[model samples]
Target: MEFKPDWEQAVRRFEAWYAFEETDRPVMIVSAPKAPRQDPPAPGDLLRRWTDAEYLIARHEAAFRSTHYAGESYPHCWPNLGPGIAGAYAGCEPVFDETTMWLKPLDRPLSGIHPVWDEDNHWWQVTLELTHAAAEAGEGRWVTGITDLGGVTDILAGMRHSDRLCIEMLEEPEEILRVRDGLLEIWKRAYSALADITQPVNGGTTGWLGAFSVHRTYPLQCDFCCMIGPEMFERFVLPELRELCRWLDRSVYHLDGPGAVKHLDALLGIRELNAIQWVQGAGQAPTIEWADLLKRILDAGKSVFAYASPQEVRPLLERLGARGVALAVGASTPEEADYLVRMSAEWSRP
Candidate 1:
């Protein structure tokens, strides 16, 4: 590992975390900027900013050069075309804005909507090009991750708007399955294709979540499940998630927000699902607010990961007891990163 000289040690730590065991300390990923960050004026075209391969690669390279990755943290460059890029690959219209990008909804009946994988889709090509360029620049320095092709049902919700998909799931349940079945195929094809490109260069694989593994692993998700009940979730989302978990060597479900907690039990039921990344979402800052929830996931027999602050790490470890707990956090200085790594041994349960 070029950027990570101590990668083998980190791998040992990660393996313990995945198996619900503690190494010398619970896994804590910490990073600090090598120097203070400054901003330059932005270009007017959001589309070019998102699509330009050289620009994207150089930007990641700059960040890699400017950040001190410590503890379990490592340099990872993931193609972030927002979460709905999968819908774009299925030929859905994309609307670019200043902060993010989204797919323009079709909002038509399921019977009329037939989504297929377009091998030559514009955004699809952009994502591939971006991955290749990032890998070239980051080959020995940083790791390149596959783009977020997104979860199948979420792609359907993006393709047909969440409101319309909610209606279709009830009024035309079978048709809902019909369309999602198609999207599921597209999801597999897209993931497999990107994995083929990333694996050889990355020496394994990583995702937007920054969790790295020597074998195939992904942060599986279906944010749309927050809209439906358990019955609907099990019917529409669970089967696809099961297939993904079975297919991949390892997986962690990205359980985001209050709305998503409802599906936790259903997700936990998947035998192959390795862990859960619990996000407290907006206004839920200072992750310690969710100690009970974090403990619940650990009790359910899966390793847990969350974003916390340096201040929250010790208390979180205290409350959760650190057995299967991992926290990804930011520090302000190289000294702070070193401090956290040393203090984590104190934070972990004996």
Candidate 2:
């Protein structure tokens, strides 16, 4: 079945901000806690729901319906298995359950290190199949694609343990490059396949009567390189990141946590990067603590994705000009969402 997208306006608006173009209004979203959903749906369930007119409503609200243990508490239906799905085809096996997925090593500290590319690999096959399922299920919903994978270091760390990866940097430097380059090839290939999948709906591609033209965009991510310092990131992660960025229309770095903040210099310096999704970590002062970081990102001439309390909305607007900030707030109903949207729009403009 042909992939379909019902939120072209939302997509274009997001792409515009992702590309750092000044938009007419900021995308003010109501970021709410997942009010317990009964019989939480999977990708297949979503597809089934999308086919039914009533189900489409549920599919559209899939984000709020999904549950996650940790990390970006967004919808789980996006199917972000890992960047090493391609690498898995080369010998790695991915483990998937109801909640999340991860790649499993073949043997002791990297035994089955084969440079193969088979769609039959556990991770690769599952993702490929899910793409079809989503295309079918997403009949008239939001687009579905894998997360924008970071370069080799990121993939390896994910496939292999971080401690093992640190050892590999010394013990198996050559293998590291082989794995890195191999994963790069695979990352690009997987994304290209997804690109083909979303092309009918303009998923990873750009161009929609906008003032700014994005050479490449969609499949947004930057989870890798954020954990390490700038030096480590430069030597191990940046090269592949550069490669990934060159392929997309507008690439935004998902700067996750204060640990990843060290790479902020490298991220801001990269010309190809369009914006930064500052994922403020949990605990006290999350939305408020990152005020300076937001300013720095803006100073670097990039956009930001932030979530604030409804009460904090006024101060947030006063502090950060809304030219490039996308708000994810929690509103009770469409009326409330509309009110906040209008308020944000008014504050953001002048």
Q: Report the lDDT of model 2 for residue 332.
A: 50
TM-score of predicted structure 2 = 0.77
**Cα lDDT of model 1 by residue, 1-350, tens digit:** 76678877876777777777756788889999987554333455778777777767767766776788789998888888888688888878888776677789885657888878889988888888998888877777778998877888888888888888898888998998888888887877888888888888877888888777778888989998888899999888998899999998879999999999988888888888889999988877569989898989889889999998899988898888767778998999988997988888887765
Per-residue lDDT of 1-350 in model 2, one digit per residue for the tens?
11222244555566667656776666564533335555435446532332333343355455434322111112223444444445455566656554444667545545456455666666566566656665555544444444434445655776777767877776777777777777777767777776567556434443111112223554334455555556667776777777767777676666777778878888788787777777767763767667888888988888887777777766676677677777677655545555666677666666
RMSD of 1: 1.7
Question: Candidate 1's error at 79, in angstroms?
Answer: 1.3
Model 1: how far residue 116 lies from native, Å: 2.2
Q: lDDT of each model, Cα atoms only? A: 0.83, 0.58
lDDT of 1 at 65: 68
Using lDDT as the measure, the top candidate is 1
| Model 2 Cα shift for residue 133 (angstroms) | 2.3
Question: Candidate 1 lDDT (Cα, whole model)?
Answer: 0.83
Report the backbone clash tally of model 1. Answer: 0
